[model samples]
Target: MKKHIVNLWAFIHLVAHRFATDGVAQTAASLTYTTLLAIVPLITISLTIFSAFPAFQTVSTNLKIFLLENMLPESAGKVISVYMFQFSENAGKLTAIGTVILAITAFLLMQTIEHALNGIWHVRRARPWTQRLLIYWAVLTLGPVLIGGSLYVTSYFTSLTLGLGHEVHGATLYGLKFTPILLTVTAMSLLYLMVPNRYVMARHAWLGGLVAGVCFELMKTLFSNYVSHLPSYTMVYGAFAILPLFLLWIYLSWMVLLLGAVITAMLPQYAQGAMAGEQRVGYQFDLAVRTLVQLSHAHLRGEVLSLVQLVKLTHIHGEMLEQVLISLQDGHWVLRTNQGWALARHPDKILLRELFERLVFDAHHAQLDLGVIVRQPDLNLSDWVRSSAQLKLGEPCR
Candidate 1:
C-alpha cells in the first residue's frame, strides 16, 4: 500500500514536470491563434468539396446545424454560423491563386499541430517537407468528406431506427443519440495515435482519448449552460458577443486537446513507475558512459539496440535515455539509423576522455564560459571524469 502511494505521487510529479517544461499554455495559445486564422479557409474548402458531390449538397447546411445544436453555446453558434456560411459562399467566387492561398493557410494550421505534438514526444526531427505536404493535403481534402459521410449515415440510420420503433425496442434509438460522443472519442484517439512522430501504443492513445472525449463533452454541456444562464457576455459585448464566445471555446478546446496529448505521452512513465514502483535513475557520468559503451559494443557485434532494449539494459527512465541519446548524436559520437543507434567511429578509437568531453563538458561550454572565474571546487571536472571512466571501463584514458 505504501509503495503504491509513493508510486502514485511519483507519477503525479512526473506529469507536472512535463506539463511545465513542455509549455502547454504557450503551445495551446499558439494553436488557438493559428486555428482562428485557418478556420474560415478550412470551412470554405470543406464546403467546396462537399458541393462537388451531388449527394453531399446538403452536408454543409446539416453540418452547420449540428455544430450549432451540439458544439456551440447559446446565440454564439447562430452568429458564427451566419458568417461561416457567408464566407463559404464567397469562397466559391475566388480565383485559382486565392484558392491556393486558402489551402496553404489550412495546411499551416495542420503543420503547427504536428509540430506541437512532435515537441511533446521530444522529437527533434520532422518528416520531409514533401511527405508532410502530401499527407496534410490528403487530410485536408478527405477529412470533410469522411465526416460528412459519417453524419449522413448516422442520420439515415437514426431515421430508420425511429421508423421501426414499433417493431423494435428503444435501445437503438438511445445508442444513436450517443453517436456524437463515439465519433468524438474515435477522432481524438486517431489524433493521439497519428500526430506524434514516434510510435504510440493503441491502448495508451485510446485511454487518453476516452478521457479527453468525456471531458470535452462535459465541458461543452457545462459551458453552454453557463452561457445560457449568464448575461454578462451579452451585456458587455451586445452585438458582438459571438466573437469572444467563439474564441473562448476554441482556446478551451486546444487546452483539452493538449492535455490529452500530455496524458498519452506520459502514460508509459505512469505505467512503469506507478504500477511497478520502478526506482528512479539519477543523472551520473558513469551511467551515460555505460549506455554508450553498450551501444558501441552492439555496433561492433553487428547488432542494433532499440530504445526499449537500452531502457531495459540500463534500467533508466525512458526520457532520460532519450536525452542521453540526443546528446550523443549532437556530439557526433553516435549516429541514429533506421534500425537503431550505431557508433560514428570504431569503438576502440573512441576515447573515454573524448566521449566524456563531448557528452558533458562541451554541453556546459556556455555556463563554463560565463564571465565569472571558476572556483577551486570546480577545477578540471573533465579530467576527473576521464580518469573515472578509464578506471571503471578498464580501458586506456587517451
Candidate 2:
C-alpha cells in the first residue's frame, strides 16, 4: 500500500513537471485557435467525402449531430453547428485551387496535432513527410466514415431494440448512456496511440483515452447546467456571445485532451521505485546503469532491444531512456540500429567510474560530497569513483 502511494505521488509529480515543461495549456490554447481556423475546411472535406459515398450520406448526417450534441455547450452548440453547416456548404462549392487551399488548412490542423503529441512523447524525429502526409490524409478521409459508421450501427441496433416495444428498457438505457463515452474513449485512444512517431503500449493509451472520454462527457454535462445562465453573456456580447463561449469550450476540451496525452506519455516512466533518484544525487547515473545493464544482457543474447522492450526491462520511460542512450552513444558505449538499441562494445569495457564521470546530474551539479572529509579528508569523489570498479566504460568500442 505504501509503495503504491509513493509511486502514485511520484507519477503525479512527474506529470506536473511535464505539464509545466511541455507547456500543455499553451499548446491547448494554440490548438483551439488552429481548430477554429481549420474547422470549416475540415468539415468541408469530410462532407465532400461523405457526398462521394451515397451510402454514408445518412451516417455523415448523424456524425454532425453527435459532434454538436456531445462536444459543445448546448446553447452555443446549436448556433455553432448551424453556422458550421453553412460554412461547410459554402466551402464545398469552391474551385479547384480553392479546394486545394481548404485541404491545406485541414492539413495544418493535422500538423499541429502531430507536433503536440510528438513533444509530449519527447520524440526528436518526425516521420518522413511522405509517410506523414499519407497517414494524416488517410485519417482525415476515413475517420468520419469509421466514426459515423459506429454511431449508425449503434443507433440502428437501438432502434431495433426499441421496435420490439418490449421491456428491454434497461439495456437500451445503459447503451444510450455509455455509447458516446465508449466512442470518445476509442477515438481518443487512437489519437494517443498513433499521433506520436513512437511506440506506445496499448494499455497505457487505453487508460489515457478512458480518462479523457469520461472527463469530456462530464464537461458536457457541466456546460449544460450553466447554459441557462448565459443570459448575462448574451446581454453583454449580444449575438456574438456564442463565439467566446464556443472558444472557451474548445480551450477546455483541449485541456482535457492534452491532460490525457500527458497521462499516456508519463505512464511508461512511472514505476514503483523509478522516482527514488529524484531525491538522491546522480539520478541520471542510476538511469544510465539500469539502461546499460539491460543493453548488456541483450548484447549477450545477440539481440537488439527496442525502446518498448527497454522500458519494460529497466522500468524507465522512453524520454529518460533516450537521454541515457545519448550519453552512452556519445561515449561509444551503445549503438542504435534500424531495428533497435544495442551495446556497441563489450559491457565490461565500460568502467563505472568513467560512466559516472562523463554523466552530469542537473540537481546535484553544485552539491559537493564532503562526507569523506570526516574520515579520509584527502579522499576526493573522483579518486573514490575511479578505483571502485574495473569495468571498462572508458575503453574504445570494438
Candidate 3:
C-alpha cells in the first residue's frame, strides 16, 4: 500500500510538472487566445446569417442574450452588441449584398475554426477539394438553417406549454420551467453536430450535448443574476478590472468546451465497452505488438529470442506475447531453436526498433532531455549476427 501510494504521488507530481513546464504553459495560453478570437467571429457570423431572415432574427437575438450578452464580460458584450446592431441595420436593406459578404466572412471564419479544432482532435484533413467544399457548405449553410428550425420548434412548444399552464394552474410554470431546458438541449445538439471531425455516435453526442447544454444554460443564468450583480472591477482594479473579467470569461468558456468534449467522449465508454463496437485493449498493445512482430519478421528472417525475454523487454503480457511469437514462428519469419528463437536476418527489424524507441523516448520527454538516461550502456545495444530484430538508427551493426 505504501509503495503504491508513493508511486501514485510521484506520477501525479510528474504530470503536474509536465503541464507546468514553460512550453506547456505557452501552448495552453496560445490555444486560449486562438479560441477566444475564434469565438467572436463564429458568433458574429452566425448572428449575421440569422439577421438576414426576419423570422430567425428574433431567435438570434434570444440566443445572443442567452449565450453572449449574459455570459460575456461587459466590455465584450458591448462590443458584440454594437457590431450586431450595425449588422441589423444594414441587413434591413440590400439583403443579398451584405448577406453575400457576411456569408463569405463566415465561411472563412469556419475554415479558420476547423483548422484550429482539427489540430486539437489530432485528425488530418484527408478530403480533396470537392469534399472540402461540400463539408464547408454543410457547416456554414445547413448549420444555421438547422438552428433556425430548432428555435421555431422550441417557440411552438413554449407557446403550447404556456397556454396549457394558464388554462390549468392560472400560471405559466411549464413554459417558464421547460423553455430553458429546451433551449439548452437545442444548443448542445447543435454543438455536438458541429464540433467534431470524425464521426461521433448520435446517442453519445446527444446525451453529452444535452448535459453540457443544460449545465451551460444554468451557469449562464446564475452568472448573469449573481456575478453581474457584483460591483464593477473599476473600484477594485481601477482601469484593469475589465481585463481580468474578460480573461475569466474566456477561461470559463474554454472549460465548458472541454467539459462538453470529455462528456461526449466518455458517454460511449460509460458502460465499459457496451457502446463501442470493438473494445481495444489498454495502451493499444495489440497494435504495437503487431507492428513489432511484423518489423522483426521482415528484417530478421532467423533471429532467435527467448519468449521470456520478449515478454519482459516488450512489456507485453505472457499470453498475447506468446501468440505473437508463435504466429511469427509459424509463418517462418522466425525459427525456434533449443536455446532461443532465430530469424532470417533482414534489415527492417532494426528500423522497427528505432521507430519504437523513438516513440518511447517521445512519450517520456516530449522534448526534454533526461541527462544520461537515454545514453546509458544498458539500453545501448550494438549489432550482432544472431541479434535478430535489433536495429539502431545511424549505428553500424557489430
- Report the C-alpha lDDT of model 3 over 79-126, residue by residue, as the tens digit: 555665565555546467755665565556556545543433334333
Best by lDDT: 2
Residue by residue across 129-161, what tens digits does model 2's lDDT show? 998998799779878777777777777887787
Clashing pairs in 1: none
Cα error, candidate 2, residue 156 (Å): 0.9
Worst 10 residues of 1 by lDDT: 367-376
* Best-first order by lDDT: 2, 1, 3
lDDT of 2: 0.82
Which of 1 and 2 is ahead in lDDT?
Answer: 2
The estimated TM-scores of all candidates read 0.76, 0.82, 0.51
Model 2 residue 89 CA deviation (Å) reads 1.7
Please, what are the lDDT tens digits per residue for candidate 1 over residues 59-82? 888778777776666567778878
After TM-score superposition, the amount by which residue 215's alpha carbon in candidate 3 deviates from its true location, in angstroms, is 3.7
RMSD per candidate (Å) reads 7.6, 6.4, 12.6
Regions of model 1 farther than 4 Å from truth: 1-9, 52-57, 165-170, 274-321, 330-333, 337-340, 347-398
Q: Give the TM-score of candidate 3.
A: 0.51
In model 3, the number of clashes is: 14
